[model samples]
Target: MQLTNLNMPVASLLACGNDPGVMTTEQAHAAMQLHLDCTVDRCLVRRRARTTLVEAGKCVLDDQAERL
Candidate 1:
């Protein structure tokens, strides 16, 4: 079940740094199929919290509420 050979567009999407939100249903299906084939024991995908520069400690914002 090695999906390395599967025709998944995941690598291209990842390279562009764009979220997979724009992917079509067919593309999503292809990616899912690839993932299922390649998964070892268990696999999970979770969304991390979206943070701003101030929250990330990269800057001190006077209007933190606005950023949030």
Candidate 2:
């Protein structure tokens, strides 16, 4: 059994970008709702942004330990 149903109209609207000619305000809203309903995926690893900050602190601490 398929767990998800596809909305062709919404899919068409979403593909149209923000063009007011092809997609209207209501259609944009429907597209937004469809986007929000999609599942988000995350990997089990340290994010690069946070890792850089953490590694910077580690390096500073290592330098201080070497000095002492």
Candidate 3:
């Protein structure tokens, strides 16, 4: 199932640029909804923004250590 269930529009071709801006999922969704008139996708936002990731073990161990 889709996150927002709105019809997603295809992203237009983008030229290579020296600088690109970044935004969060919520922010991207809002911008697309307002400007593009489509929800696009929650997952694609992360990929386009190059978000960071953490290993499951690292996250779980860090949380456990903090609680001790």
Candidate 4:
């Protein structure tokens, strides 16, 4: 997805910045046009968001397992 097409608000990135379950630096850079890391393969931020969600789900499952 194009950077402009993601349509995520700037506040969302700010809120998610400290969360490990959020997007990688590359994705965040793409989101806010910060150009923090330009060496990564140009991937759509939306795809990264989806991948982050999947990883976050796995983390939750792992935590639940520890609690059981």
Candidate 5:
């Protein structure tokens, strides 16, 4: 997936800076570690927001079906 397309929390975790067009393998690992290490309550809001963003993206894609 494109780093630039990532939502705010995920992009921040990758630490690829403001305009992250690409990410290194180490950055990917660190981001995953951070995600795995965080406690559920601490990450709950972020997780919820990410879920909402994903659902919204799906809706956008589903719009094409409605158009047809």
Candidate 6:
């Protein structure tokens, strides 16, 4: 699993300065943490999606008649 790809957006948001919302450093850190956490959640969701697709494909193949 490539965690770095998932973290790129979080890192970019953290590196940005001059927040339009006037967020403090602490607030920014918290927001970045939240983003990282959400990214992890998304990765898990993607993994599950892939697993389901593979399982469905296998099921379809299993139900098909053998070709000579």
Reference-based lDDT, residue 56, model 3: 18
Ranking of predictions according to lDDT: 4, 5, 6, 1, 3, 2
lDDT by residue (1-68, candidate 2, tens digit) is: 11123323333433323222333333333443444543212211112212333344532335543343
Single out the weakest 10-residue window by summed lDDT for candidate 6.
Answer: 59-68
TM-score of each: 0.29, 0.26, 0.25, 0.25, 0.27, 0.25
Q: Flag regions of model 6 displaced more than 4 Å.
A: 1-20, 37-68
lDDT of 3 by residue, 1-68 (tens): 24244233323212122112454344334433443432223334432333211221212235543343
Candidate 6 per-residue C-alpha lDDT over 1-68 given as tens digits, one digit per residue, 9 for 90 to 100: 23343433434344333232433333334444444544423343322323333454531223332220
Q: In order, how many clashes per candidate?
A: 0, 0, 0, 0, 0, 0
In lDDT terms, how accurate is model 2? 0.32
Residue lDDT tens for model 5, 1-68: 54444444464563322332333444443343445655324554334333343454522325543342
lDDT of 1 by residue, 1-68 (tens): 33344344445433223344443334444444544433312322101112222344543436653443
Which pairs clash in model 2?
none
Worst 10 residues of 3 by lDDT: 11-20
Best by TM-score: 1
Best by lDDT: 4
Q: Give model 4's clash tally.
A: 0
Candidate 4, residues 1-68, lDDT tens digits: the string is 45544455544543323232367544544543442342123433433443454465622335543342
Candidate 2: residue 33 Cα off by (Å): 0.2
- Score each candidate by Cα lDDT: 0.36, 0.32, 0.32, 0.42, 0.41, 0.36
* True lDDT of residue 15, candidate 2: 33
In candidate 4, how many Å is residue 4 off?
17
How does residue 27 of candidate 4 score in lDDT?
52
Q: What is the lDDT of candidate 5?
A: 0.41
